[model samples]
Target: MADPQEPRMTAKRFHARPGVEDWRVLFWGAHAFYAADSLTHAVALASAVAEIADGLDHHPDLDVRPHGVTIRTRTRRGGGLGPLDAELARRVQEFARGEGYRPDPSTLMVTGIAVAQDRDADVRPFWAAIMGYEPLDDADAVDPQRRNPHVWVHELTPPKPGRGRTHIDLSVPADHAKARVEAALAAGGRLVSASPEGWTIASPDNHGVDIAIWPDFEDFGEDG
Candidate 1:
C-alpha cells in the first residue's frame, strides 16, 4: 500500500473519464472545420493550429486538408471530459467563433470559413481600427488566449484590385454602438454605412468586414 503522504494514482488523476462528455457545448466532442482552397493555404491553417496548441500546452489531433481540416481533442489523463478538457474545448470553440466559423447545433455542423484578404501593407492597423479587435503580438499569437482568436494575414500571392464587400453586419447597442464605431474608426477603420439603428464599418480596401449597431430593446421604446 502507498503511504498516505504519497500521491495516489487514482481515476481522478485522469483528465477526462470515459463516461464524462459534455454535448451541449460546441467544443465538447470532436470538431472539424471545412474549406481550404490550396495546399499552401492548408499548410498555413495547420500552422495556425500548431500555434494554438503550443500556446495551450494541450495538443490536439489534426486532420489537415487542402480544402479543409479537422481538429479532434481528447484528454489523455482523464480519458474523458474534465476541467482541463473543458478548458481546451472552450479554447477551440472560441477560436472557431472568432474566425467566423458558424456552428450548427444538431450534428455539430460547425464548418465553413470566411476569407478576408488585404493587399495594402498597412492592413493590420486598418482591420484593427475597424473591428475593435485587440491586436495580439507574436508572443500572444502563439499562446492562445481566451479573449481574441488568431487571424493570419498571408501574402496576397498576386495583388489584384477587386470591388466587392467582404464583410458582415455587427449589431450592438445603439448607444454603445456609436462609441464602438467611433473607437473602431479611430483605430484606422473606415465607415461604409450608418443610420439610427447602426453603422457599417469596413477595411481600407472596402472588404465586407462591416459592423452594425442596434438600439437596445429598452431603448427601442417598448413598454415594459
Candidate 2:
C-alpha cells in the first residue's frame, strides 16, 4: 500500500521520476487527459481511476466530458505533487492501457487573469463578488468549480495609463514554454521580458499576455 503521508515532491522531481510521462505539472497540480473514442469509454476510465484512488485513499478531481476525461491530482494536506499522486497515476495508467485509453499530455494547460491595481483590496472584492468566485487568498480569486481561469490582483507600484492594467496568463508544462514563445513571436507578438518565472509578452494590440512557467526550474532555460 502506498503511504498516505509522504515527503513533498517538487514538480521538477516529479517529472524526473520514471512512469509519469502521461502527466503534466501545471499551475496548481498535476493533470492528465485521456482521449477516449466515446463518452462510454471515458466513463469507464474514470471509474477505474476512482477505484485506484479509493484504494490508495487519495482522491483526484475527475472531469468527464463527451470526448475524454481530465484527471487532476493534488495533495490534500499540502500543495503540489506528493509521492501518493505518482503511485495513483501509475496504477490508473495501467488500467487505462488495458482499456485502450491513451493520454495526450500536450493538451494539458492552465490559464488565469491578472488584474493590475494599486488598490488591490478595493478592487479584489468586486471581481470576486461579481464573478461569484471564492478568494484563494487576499490578493487572488478562483472559480470554486475550477472551470474558469484564476483571477489575480496584481499590484502596480505606480499606476499609470497606456500601460498594462491587466494581463492574460497562459501556463503550461516547462517543456512547452519555449515553443509557445516562439509561436507567439511568429504571430506578431512582441517580446517584453523572459525569466525563469516565465515570459512577459505583449500582443500586437499592446495587451499584456504572460507565458508562465510554474515549478520554476532551469529545465530548458527561458526563451530568448
Candidate 3:
C-alpha cells in the first residue's frame, strides 16, 4: 500500500472532443501501458517520458498509474490521426521495441523484421565456399533468388563479441504489445514474458522473436 503522503494514482479516460473526427485528430484514441509495481515506478516513468517529450516538442495527455502511465498523444490541430501523432507513436514504439515488448496483432501489424547475423565473417566464408555466388563489395555474400529476397546485409560495428548467433527482432504498433502476444501464442508461438517492458514469443522450432509495438511513424520530431 502507498504511504499516506504518497500521491494517489487513479484510472482515467480521454476521448476526442465531439465532431473532431478528422484524420489528423482522430487517427488514434488514448494510449495505455502498465507501470512497474512500485511507487517510485511512476516517478521514473514520468521522468523518462518528460525527457523524451522535451526532445520531441510533442506533448501527450498522461495518466499516472501506480505501476505505469498511460499517454494519449494526438494532434488536436490535425483532428484525429495526423503526422505528429504517428511520429510520437513510432518513437515510443522504438523505445519499447528495444526493451523487448510485443504488440498484439489485433492492434498492429508487423511492419518489418531484421535478422542480425553477428557471425557474418564465419557464415560468409562457409557459404561462399559451398555456393558459387560472387562475393559482394561489403564482404557479405548473398544469392538474390535463394535468400530472403528482401533482407539486406550490412557490416557490424566493432564486430560481435564471443559466440553470438543470429537474432530476430519484430516490430509492431506501440499499443498492441499485449494483443500481439496473444495472437502469436494462438498462432503456435509461445509466450515468454508478461513484464512491463513487453512480451516475448517463440515459434515451435525454438526460433524466437520480439514483437515490439510502437506508435505510427509520424510521432517523431523529424517526421515533421
Candidate 4:
C-alpha cells in the first residue's frame, strides 16, 4: 500500500516515469493531452475518465472536442501535482491507448497576452473592460466564458520605452516545444531566447511570443 503522507511528485520526477515520458507532462504541473477520432469518441472517453476519477476521488480538467480531449490534473488542496495526479494520468493513458487513441501533444495549445506595466492597477481595468474579461486576479484577466486567451499584466520597473509592450504567450506540450520552435523559425520567426522552460520567438514584424512548455497554473507567474 502507498503511504498517505508521502511527498508529492515534483515536475522532474513526474517526467521520469515510464509510459508518461512520452506524454506532454508539464514541468510546472501534471497534465496529459489525448486525441480522439470524433466527437462521439471524445464523449465516450470523457465518460470513462469521469468514472475513474469518481472512483479515485480525484478529478481532472477535461476539455472534450470533436476530435480530441485534453486532461489536466493537479492537487488543488496541495497547490501542485501529487501522486494522485500521476496515478490518474497513468490510468487515463492506459484507457486512451486501449481505445486506439494515441497521445498527441501538438493538438493542445494555450495562448495568453502579456502586458508590461509599471503598476498593475494602472492598466488592468482598461484591458479587462475592452476584452470583456473578468479578473482572475489583480495581475490577470480571463474570458468569462473561457473562449478567449488570458491577458496578463506584468509589473516592470522603469517600463521599457517602446510601442511593443505586449506579447503573446503560447503554452504547448513539453514534448512538442522544440518542434514548434523549429517550425516557427522556419516560418520567418527569429529566435529571441531559449531556455528549458521554453523559447521566445519573434515574428517578422518584431512582435515577440513565448513558446512555453510548462502548464499554465494560475498565480504562478509566466514561469509556471
Tens-place lDDT per residue, model 2, 1-224, is 22345445677776777777888877667788899888888888888898899899999889998789998887732235677878877887777777788888667778888998763235778899999988875567988877788888877768664454778988777777898889999999999999878999998999989887765332432111
User: TM-scores, in order shown?
Assistant: 0.31, 0.84, 0.32, 0.77
Relative to the true structure, how large is the alpha-carbon lDDT of every model?
0.43, 0.77, 0.45, 0.72
User: Who wins the lDDT comparison?
Assistant: 2
The candidates, ranked best first by TM-score, are: 2, 4, 3, 1
Give a tens-digit lDDT track for model 1, residues 65-142.
Answer: 566555655442211223444455556556555664433322222211123444654355555555454444421111
lDDT of 4 by residue, 184-210 (tens): 899999998997778999999999999
Q: What does candidate 3's lDDT look like per residue over 140-167, in tens digits? A: 4444332221122444555674443443
Model 4 residue 162 CA deviation in Å: 10
* Lowest summed lDDT window (length 10), candidate 4: 215-224
Where does candidate 2 stray beyond 4 Å? Answer: 1-7, 76-79, 119-121, 161-164, 216-224
Which model, 1 or 2, shows the larger TM-score? 2
**Pairwise TM-score winner, candidates 2 and 4:** 2
Model 1, stretches more than 4 Å misplaced?
1-29, 77-79, 101-224
Clashes of each: 14, 0, 38, 0
lDDT (Cα) of model 4: 0.72
Model 1, residue 58: distance off in Å is: 0.6
